[model samples]
Target chain A: MPTISFDGQEITFEPGQTIIEAAMASDLYIPHLCWHPDFPPHGSCKLCSVKVNGRICSACTFPAAEGQEVVSSSEEVRQLRLRLTQMLFVEGNHFCPSCEKSGQCELQAMGYYLGMTDNHYPHFFPVRDIDASHPHVLLDRDRCIFCELCVRASRADGKNVFELAGRGIHTRLVVDSPSGKLGDSNLDVNDRAAHICPVGAIVVKETAFRIPIGQRKYDRRTIAEVSVAEEAPLLRKRYEQKED
Target chain B: MSKKKIRIATTSLAGCFGCHMSFMDIDERLLDLAEIADFDRSPLSDIKHCEQCDIGIVEGGVCNAENVEVLREFRNHCKILVAIGACAINGGIPALRNRCDLGDCLEEAFLTGIGVTDPKVPGDPELPLLLDKVHPVHEVVKIDYSLPGCPPSADTIWAALTALIEGNAPQLPYELIHYD
Candidate 1:
């Protein structure tokens, strides 16, 4: 067993367990965006970054070893997370006003919680198109954070509908075939990508305001808080039971 | 009282009280703040009416008529105006509404929606209306300092106040530096 301490709380884990899994197994919260238990760790959002022996590493994917000392809430950790979240904000056109996902939006909540006040960086405001082709869903390219959660969900879940085209800063989510609008792409709204979007980039069409602002899923809890509970075995088992 | 001792007023306009609360969240250190500064007009203090203060901290956003009046008065009275919080510094969460047309929102919220009140909504008001866009404080007024954050962490707040108390420009911790 490998042991680790996050901000002084000790947790032991089996070999190969990620710091995120170990932290959650012992009830320690580590904030994250692109890492999910069911899905492999994609360190894009970088919110789950932590300090390991005074060095920054993404906890969602970092391997925990014997006597590994982790610091989750240190100033260093916060600084990194803040920059990452800010990058996500400026990287997209996240005007919350016209967005149907305002309260439910994770990017807004994280930005606030982490104290991102100014977009110190220039707003790229890259020209992105809104795909309203999907009758049941809307894809606003400007709002996408490129977490690849959607891509992972589609591929892992065997749908093969969503895929990343291009590379690096120019990367984007695109339909699997014909390059037609998502509505014409034969994609389903119930796909995993639709459910895991951290922002309003992908939203269900008809139910935009079906749930009021204050009542959306992640509005009440921090991203760390929600993911920790979801990672628990008992909770996962219970969720699976409900689905079955 | 004694030659106005650099009158400083703190007020919150369209934002969560957290920034103001964080100001008070300084806890016992507030006693130190009280000693050096004269509280003229602050939501936390009794003195209303901006009586030509030296510094004004405007929090939140300009969503209503009252906000416009308060912000304008602060700009008029204070020698230095600081935009605090993401809401005041930028449009913040409230600015999210800026994406939608105010006229349409007014109709949806006050007229056709479930919370319909006076069937006839006022087409105009006494206060100056916000522009089609909700802008950051610097966009509206000359901001002396911008302490950003949904509500910046308490440590950042402490550092800012300490610097102000010491008559030195506050240095935001390097690790705390984040551009929204």
Candidate 2:
């Protein structure tokens, strides 16, 4: 077993593991939005940025090296995360008070974790369309963070139902169907992509606000606490099975 | 000798007044707050215009020309201005109209809306003109602090007010901070 210094704490990691993966295995959480354990790292969100030997790198894609010093919670890294979160808020129509994902949203939780009290930048307030064509799932593009979790999940499921279209600032999520609608696509309500959105973008119809406010996930506890408690065991089990 | 009391003023524009209600939710703590602070131009005092004050707490977004004027007045008069609740921080619900054309919105509400008696948009000169878009307070003027929530919990308001009165930056715990 090789060891790395993560924020001055010694943690052991197995070879071929990314810094975020190793951190997860050790019950540590590096704040992230796009990186999911089930999918390959996308490094799109950049929320998991950490300093590796004084150089900033996306922890989800950066390989953990032996004896490397990883600074994840420094003032510089925290400020970077704060600005990134603020950018995400201003870049989208993230009216959290009216959003169904207010409490459970990973982005909102990340804002709370970063102590973000205001939208530091002027909002873009981009005009976006909502795809309620699907009977079961609704695609509210207004809330999409372009994390591409759904894109990867649908691909992993061999559906390829979602894709990112357009260029920088104009980038958007589009359905892979003839009519360009979620209803016309092959995405069933049970698809991993349907429920994989970290935000309220692709929510199952008739399930909005099912969990009352203040009782939803990330409400009572911070994202760091909830993420570590729920993900650490799953990662540990997966690694254990891999060894077997 | 008595210490000089901190003068605080508050106002609501384009909001439901829920944030002001939450401020009142501080309940008996208002007694404690009154001991150290004097209400200047608040809903409680019924003062129409803001006077020179130590703190100005604004609740709502800039939806119409009047909101911009009121916010600017607070910014000019107060030593520190705090934007309270989601509306003031990011144009909470009223901003939903940002995606739609203002003419469409007004026509829908005044002309095409269901069960309308007289379909006519009001054109009174006294009515404040609507802006093209709803904007958070900071977009119009500098805000020294922001306490975010739908109507930030009563405890959150209390904590922030006390901290500001004491000349200390607010340090809200995890449980106290929420967007909804």
Candidate 3:
């Protein structure tokens, strides 16, 4: 197994492993949206852009070859991410206070992680529609970042329920049915796509705030702390070091 | 001769006054702050008019003609105008009404609303005219800085204040900058 040096630590990985996957395995977080372990990387959300050998690339798709130097924690990267977060913030009506996914949203957590103190850019506040036609799932296009997690999730599981439509800045998520609504699609409350949305765009109806604010997953521990998949080994190493 | 104490003014326009309460959550730190800063025009002091100040904190979204006038006055008097909390930053929960027509909202609330005994929308001249839409502070006037929590945490407000006081760039840890 060849190793790549990320930030400064060497992370060993098998061939074809992306920087993001290896880093996650070693409990190193690279701020990202539109990425999940269960599917291929879409790279739609550029929040995971990192400097690999001084070239910017998506960590979730960038392969970790032998001796690859990746910088994920530089001030420059933070600034870029902050601006990107601002773009997302003003591009749509992500009025966080009124949103159901305020506490648990990955996009909101990413903004905090990057220290986006304010939305510096003038807001677009584009008008969007919310589709509550689904019996169980709610589709609030205003909150959607077009991550396509739902689209990819549906494809992976053969549901074919969600897809991306339009182009450029007009790009948006669409349902694969005769009517352009979730209710016409095959998605259900139990669908994996329904649960994979990183934002509040797709949510279970009548379940808003079921889990109290401060008790939500990202609230208890930061998205970075919770994102570390290899916490056990990292913790055990620290524990053994304490005994020494 | 003594150093001039920093003057701070805050106002809530169309919000729930949660930001002001959260500001108070600084607790005993207010004692330390008292040595360096004084309230010029704030709900805490019940001041009626904003005077010349070092910092102006505008809470809540601007939703009426009077709110616009007060916000402009704050801008004219204060050296730095900071929009605190979500309402001040991006209209917060109040901006939800931006989706519907103002006439429809008024009609729903005062005319055809449930449990209403009389359906008369108040038409008094004393009432301030409503703006066409609820607007974040920056949309109405220049905001030097903004803190974008639903009600920015006490520590977040403290960090911004002390950073301005100490004359440094305000930086916050990951946990402090929440949108909710």
Candidate 4:
């Protein structure tokens, strides 16, 4: 067992756990989007960036070490997270009012948690395609944040149906099929990839606005509260199961 | 001695006036607000032009040349400009047009749309020129504060306004701050 100081609070972690995993096990949220318990660390979204011993590092990828001091809730880290959230908003067409994933979306919840009052940047307003070809699911590339949760999930499922192509600002999610469409790919409705999107990019069909505006997840509680109460328990259980 | 009332002005540019309706949703609280503030130019007052005011609350995106002109003029007249609602903050639904070509949008609306008898784009001199894209108010002018929501709840608007009137920064709680 190793101990690390997270935001001035001493927390314990196993030898191989990342900062995020260690934080979750202790019920301390680091405000992450790409680091889910079921998947390996992708480290794409930098919302989980924390200052480890005065050096900035992605908590999802940074290993928790003994005697290390990690600052997650400091003003500097909070401002950085806010700016990253704003950048994510402007980089895509995140029209939350019109988006189906408005309430349940991790990005939207992160924006709320960061107290984002405005976009604070000019919107890129890039043209993105929407693939409604899939009978059970819809692919709206406008909302993708390149977190690659779906990419990992599909690969873990042995589907390899989703992949990232292009580079820099031109990078986009592409299907494995020749037609470059979700319907033409081997992605099934029941696949983990279909339900793993942190944003509204890939959503099940006929499930839009299933929950009312004020009643949805992240509507009543803040992301930090929800993450600790709902997600931390599951993550802790998984860790305990692994140990047994 | 009586306190000097704060002057507030508001306007809508390219929105559905839903935000304005939300403001009116303040309901009986409007009477409480009237004691501390006076309306200079607003939909409630029916004033066409803005006057020098302590706060200028604008709700809408900049879609046409007239919107830009109005926003600039409004920005110049107020000490603090608050962009209220999703339209004023992020262009809202009108920004969906940003993905499409302006020419294509006009042609589809007037010329190629269903049941179009006389198909021609209007070029009247009186009409304001449409901008290439719908932009949030901050893109056109500097906004002092932005309250995000489709139409921010009456309580949220009340909280921000009262705080602004008292010369304090708006500290919206987690429940009050929502994009939708």
TM-score of each predicted structure versus truth: 0.65, 0.98, 0.87, 0.98
Q: In model 3, what are the clashing residue pairs, if there are any? A: none
Backbone collision tally, model 3: 0
**What CAPRI class is candidate 3?**
medium
Interface RMSD of each: 7.0, 0.7, 1.8, 0.6
Q: What C-alpha lDDT values do all the predictions have? A: 0.72, 0.93, 0.85, 0.93
Candidates 1 and 4 compared: the better one by TM-score is 4
> What range of 10 consecutive residues in model 3 chain A has the weakest lDDT sum?
A230-239
Ordered list by TM-score, greatest first = 4, 2, 3, 1
Better of 2 and 3 by TM-score: 2
Displacement of residue A97 (Cα, Å) in model 4 is 1.2
lDDT of 2 by residue, A1-244 (tens): 9999998999999999999999999889999999888888899899999999999999999999999999999899999999999999999999887788779999999999999999899999999889999999999999999999999999988999999999899999999999999999999999999999999999998887889876899989989999899878877887888899
Task: Please identify model 3 stretches exceeding 4 Å from their true place.
Answer: A230-244, B107-129
- lDDT: worst 10-residue window of model 1 chain B: B171-180
- Ranked by lDDT, the better of candidates 1 and 4 is 4
Clashes in model 2: which pairs? none
Model 1 over residues A15-115: C-alpha lDDT tens digits? 77788878877767777767667777887677888888878888888899888889988887788788887777766777665567866777776765665
Candidate 4 per-residue C-alpha lDDT over B1-180 given as tens digits, one digit per residue, 9 for 90 to 100:
999999999999989899999999999999999999999888889988888999999999999999999899899999999999999998999999999999999999989999987999999999999999999999989999999998999999999999999899999999999898
The i-RMS of candidate 1 is: 7.0
